[model samples]
Target: MRIGLDIGGTKIDAVAVAPTGQTVDRVRVPTGFGAEQVVANTLQVIDALRGRTGTTPTAVGIGIPGLIDHETGWVRHAVNLGLSEVALGPLVAEHVGLPVQVENDVNVAALGAAQAMHLDGAHAYLNIGTGLAAGIVVDRRLWRGARGNAGEVGHIPVLADGPPCVCGQRGCLETVASGSALAAAWPGHPGTTATEVFDSADAGDPAATAVRDRFVAGVASAVRILVVTVDVDSVVIGGGLAALGERLLLPLRADFDEAARSSPFVASLGLSSRVLLAPLDQPLAALGAAHLAPESAVTTA
Candidate 1:
């Protein structure tokens, strides 16, 4: 068995997966603030899964939200988790006595989503959740850029005068498109979550509808940016807002279709067909993490 963990902004998801990709056991715990609590909470979840499985995992893989030095397994920064320069892989390896491989969460999720969809060649995983970002795969391999921040498209400037981003920039796409942005901009209610905004829009609230429309447009723009830039096979949408299902995809599809009808260049790209929603039930990031370490790293322990 192998242990896979996805350390997300809100929750840390861990799973024990058999060789056949079947889940042996899974556990989730709320993500803790600060580096120490995050590591402690992650270990607690791992131990719980190990107890349930009654065996030490052959290898362990972790997906964290930040710029990870893949060679050292040190996280340069994970803003949402309040972590910086934390040696997460070494810490987890010492605690579990297992070989550990840590990667950026979205990059691992890209692999997971590709595996789940049985995709090959090139694909882009567009995650519009707590923040907006993407993970790219080329020829079945992760295209981590020179700085291991290849897919940090969230900070891409979409508006000249957009809201501020934690990355010390204004007009970032995340400022307008992310779940955090949606919650902050909800017209009908204060502290309304992205999911709640979708709910209210579904109920025909005009104010909520306006926000939803703009959000969808922003999402469409993200899709266009990915396709025009990379021309990947498909752009798979995953993350917290993905739970809204067709409520999200349908509008996005309509927008793309309209764009295609207006511009032959858009139609020629067939961008709408390439945009897809990720499966709801799949724990892709964790599953991808399970396969991250090579076979040589698996220990008898």
Candidate 2:
């Protein structure tokens, strides 16, 4: 058996997958702060999942939010998670009596999405959630930088002098294009989430329409950077904001179509449909963590 955990800002989900990669048991629990509680919750879920099956998993993997240092299993920093400098992998491994592999939540999802596409060799996966992040894959492997922090498409500067981002940067793609940005831009509106913004956009409200358009432009602007910087043939867009479907993608495609006319990098390459939805069900982070576990049967190259 293979155990996979998806650790998030507020919740932790764990699943036991059979050797064939089919989920056989699952458990969900609220995530606690600090190193001790996080591991406790994870153990709680793992024990429950294992209890249901009365079998020990061969290995465990986790897809975790925030910036994780893959080499040392240290969480360098993650504001939303209220954690920094916590060594996660060794702690979990020691506590659970199993080998543990950790991966960035976004990168895991990207890998899972790419695996679904069968587009090995090279690809880029962008996930637009509370914020924006991308996962770059090189020849079927995740390209983590020295600190395991790569594919951070959110921090790239987009607007010269725009609103301040939670990351302490101004005019970042995430501040303008992410679900949090949409929720912030229209606080007085009836709804409190990105889904509400889409309903308003679909209803043709002017303020909502303006907010939607600006966010889409930010997305397009970011994609332009990703496509040029990484030179990937396909870009997959997923996460909470992508639930808007064409509300986000159509405008982005139009923007890309117009911008590529003057761009050098994209002129020689074929961008596949500009934006494609990620196929990982129930979010990719935890599932991707499952993929990183030693027992995962990754499709062959």
Q: Residues 174-259, candidate 1, lDDT per residue (tens digit)?
A: 87778877977874454447768888888999988888988998888888888888878899999878887798899999999998
Per-candidate Cα lDDT values, in order, are: 0.84, 0.74
Ten residues in a row with the worst lDDT in model 2?
A: 292-301
Candidate 1: worst-modelled 10 consecutive residues by lDDT? 292-301
Per-residue CA lDDT of model 2 for 1-301, tens digit only, reads: 8788888878998877777756777788998887778878878888888889899887777778777766556677766667788777777777777777777888877766665566676677888888898898776567776655567889877779988987798988899888888888988543356767767888989888888888888777667677778777678888767777766677778777766688755555544374676763654555556667363322112
Query: How do the predictions measure up, each by TM-score?
Result: 0.87, 0.84
Off by over 4 Å in 1: 54-56, 187-191, 199-206, 293-301
Error of 1 at 77 (Å): 2.9
